[model samples]
Target: MDIVFEELDYCETHMGDLMLRKRSIPSLDGKIIYEVKLGEEFLMSSLFHDAEVALSHLGLDSFGTKQVDVVVGGLGLGYTAQAALEFPNLRSLTVIEGLSEVIGWHKRGLVPLGEKLTQDSRCRLLHGDFFELAQSANLDPEHAGRKFHAILLDIDHTPEHFLHLSHGGFYQPEGLEKMARHLHPGGVFALWSDDKPDEGFCKVLESVFASVEAHLVEFDNPILGGTSSNSVYVAYAQ
Candidate 1:
């Protein structure tokens, strides 16, 4: 297969080091999308569409009926953010991206598809660590008594197949506890994973929230009928 490379950039996430590259392949539905890698490991390919669906599965209602505020942890090609914007009841949408360049790519039109979401009136893009924002959102005095209707995290590959070591904390007991604090009572906490996290994540969710559920999302292609499984875990605060 002949692959055409467009641009390459470096990024360091909590997990470790990653190289973001743009590539073009005729077989890839003739569309060019960014691909992410950690050292030699193939973290994620742009061809997959499950990320957007996982992000959108949070199921938030329009603000007219009930105001909803959302905090999305990773921007990632803007699919998730784009889906979140579909909600009419959304009061505010804050997207926290750890990489400044990723955000820049969206602004400069390199990733033209994501630009509108970043520029939307309801959206605010923050260039910083997602965990820090998670912590601040939970404890900030100014935001006291305020909580997000939905907290959607699509960082790392998945809890079970993490690209970075530090990402493990997000699936741990302490991490889930802190994450739960940021969610409004009855609000949803949705996590996207490349694969199921060996039941440990569910146990952690159970320990922190009143209910936990998992949904399996499978991808099928036209030619080979390619299939990959991704899981969405939803935890609700009592």
Candidate 2:
């Protein structure tokens, strides 16, 4: 089967070059979303349903029956946002994407998978620096004290192997501390990583959160299968 590329968007990041391609075929129900090759490999796509499930699980567990506010760091294919919206208790979902072009792709409906999510009244897509947003959330009195019930981050493959070196701080002790501060006491923080990080990263998480655990997510499809597993790190603020 051949994949037809319908649209292409390019972005030059401090780390390297990145592109998003919208591909489709008659047999598929909707357009397939692909993040163009980064370094030498393609990161992820709409085809991976398990990764999205991992994100949804976190929100469902945290929200319970109360209206929960969520802050999702990356808006990849709107999977996390879509999952957040599924929960009736979700009061608001703020999806912050670092790249402006990525936001455009969603707004233009290039990635049909995320079209409904982008249009949801509860979903707010912000085009800005995620790290900055995270930091600002910690400083603003109105936001700082308001702990988001759940924070889902899918920004990088791993905390250590940041897509951009400047983002390295996010994985460090200070960064985790800042993140913990933003969470309402007992709130949960969930992160998605393409690969597992070193023990040091786990230790950093443990230092801030009362408890920390990693869950491995596996997919069944052959094209989406292999040893390529996504790890979800969950931590609860003390």
Tens digits of lDDT, candidate 2, 68-149: 8888888877887887788888898888888776788788886765579777899888777777666665522334466677
lDDT of 2: 0.74
Error of 2 at 117 (Å): 1.5
On the 0 to 100 scale, the lDDT of residue 172 in model 2 is: 78
Q: Superpose all Cα atoms of candidate 2 onto the true structure and report the RMSD in Å to 1 decimal.
A: 3.2
Clashing pairs in 2: 147-184
Off by over 4 Å in 2: 1-3, 11-15, 24-33, 38-41, 137-146, 224-227
57-161: candidate 1 lDDT, tens digit per residue: 555532246878888888767777777887766788888887777787677776645669867899877787776656555432345656788888887777765
* Local distance difference test, candidate 1: 0.72
Q: Estimate every model's Cα lDDT from 0 to 1.
A: 0.72, 0.74
After superposition on all CA atoms, what RMSD does each candidate show versus the true structure? 3.2, 3.2
